[model samples]
Target: MENTESRNTAFEDIGQRISKAAKASRRSVSDIELVAISKTRTADEIRPLLDRGHRVFGENRVQEAAGKWPELRQDYADVELHLVGQLQSNKAADAVELFDAIHSIDRLSLVKALAKAMDKLDRRIPCFVQVNIGEESQKGGCAIEDTASLISQAQAAGIKVAGLMCVPPSNVSPAPYFALLAKLAKGNGLKGLSMGMSGDFESAIMLGATHIRVGTALFGERSSAG
Candidate 1:
């Protein structure tokens, strides 16, 4: 009970901070969805947040999420799970079945696979096209030049292109990257911008992020899922 109260307190503290940030940005607090990232955290660590009424959560891998969330969701039916990690082409069907939103749709092949999965399973999960905003060779998003075409192709294949997502270059100011992602989303008629993590979520909200994926700030440091 004490632990649950602590969790509730922490969740409310973050919510208040997010609300204040949204107001400062001239956006309604209700408009922003706080996705408490539960990547390496166990369901035991996550349930307190769920008990405190945090319905949205993000995970980095399909297998890890699969290990826990099914049982958690069985208890809390209102949970909205998001995939915040890179998705493989072969995992599209499982991803479609598990996640409510996907924030890492980055390539043409994934676009096609997700489309087919959604069609075959009769479930359409919203997807955010991850743009390689920093253009890092080792990252997981599509190149900025290819973003528009990929989104178009995804749309053509009947996948719901929700918006754009990006992880800015580390150790650099993320404002420009967030602003650029917002610009691209607006230009392409997309609305959701899935950016920002623990450190820069306030900046992202200021720059028009409808979905902020926060992990460490809310959950503290995770040891290891294993």
Candidate 2:
């Protein structure tokens, strides 16, 4: 089928890119994970990618993920679900139950809610802080000014402080921002950095990203699952 072919082509393209980047950077291809972001795509599209051996996925909206995860889990129980969106406090319980990683914790209130949710469910979860390295007011991230303090709060609440995640501002060089995050993560000795996306992933890899939230490049334009 055409969809299957597209998935194959996309996988090959991503593999080629990863190989080239890893070679260029002199880092092992196995070091970095290419999370095939399946935000708006359906099972028809995602199944092919999973069949191709992509076990990690990123979803941008909690609502969308809530609808798709059940079906996706039925087929791929081993799939790792990552919530890469601005998580609302009301959705903390659902997120803790559904996602393997929360890559957008940028507020103290959000962290408190997540901690409570995890405690209530008696499950320890992995999570990351979203830093606004680009300083874009439109984007949802902890302003760089308050990062260390935020981390302390999460730590006190018994939340697993995994790493940091960030979105580079559009229409500009994101390298400096990525570098800043890299330095910050190192300073904190964090274990993960879910930076970069379809457009700026190579740069992200170069700056020591452990995970990339690739959506469009992996699944084509957003599929209206509604």
Candidate 3:
């Protein structure tokens, strides 16, 4: 577990870094949102950051988030949860109910399922079309060539298409991939770029990333699979 003083300090340091990067890119610091990925972290480990008033968090699995956040949100009114992993069609309704934003709308089937779920529930959660910017076969995102079509389908179904999200190929310079995701968002008239992580967030901010998902830096390191 992390002490309160260190957790506060880490949060502030990341905030300062975000401000500097946003300024260097000629963008407003307020325009960028820092989503502290809390997947695999326990509520005891997460409460200190929440105590510091950081409300936005990212979780990879709906079941894990459901176990923790329903109670947390009851305690903190401002909490905003983001689904940052590939969502299954079967879990669309549950995801729609739990997450304030969904960042992995990558396929036509998912788009259709989420749309129906939102309609049935009467909630309109914002969505980000995850793009396979690196074109990796094992990864879970729409191929770059199919992004526009997915966006159109999402919009037509009344889903609030917030922007684009991507995880660039690992162990490589991610700047170009970040830049490409930014370009794709701009070309498609989207605003949010959910591209950076703990390692390359500064570069992502410079490349017009509106949202960054930082896990390890904020939470020290995850202990086990959730």
**What TM-score, computed on C-alpha atoms, does each candidate reach?**
0.96, 0.95, 0.97
Model 1, span 1-226: residue lDDT tens: 7766766777888888899899899999988999999988888999888877789999999999999999999999989999999999999999999999999999889988999999999999899999999999999999999999999999999988989999999999999999999999998999999998899999999999999998888887666654
| Candidate with the larger TM-score of 2 and 3 | 3
Give the residue spans of candidate 1 off by over 4 A. 1-5, 224-226
Count backbone overlaps in model 2. 0
Off by over 4 Å in 2: 223-226
Q: Give the whole-model CA lDDT for all candidates, comma-separated.
A: 0.92, 0.86, 0.93
TM-score of 3: 0.97
Candidate that scores best on lDDT? 3
lDDT of 1: 0.92
Question: lDDT of candidate 2?
Answer: 0.86
Candidate 3: where is the Cα deviation over 4 Å? 224-226
Better of 1 and 2 by TM-score: 1
TM-score of 1: 0.96
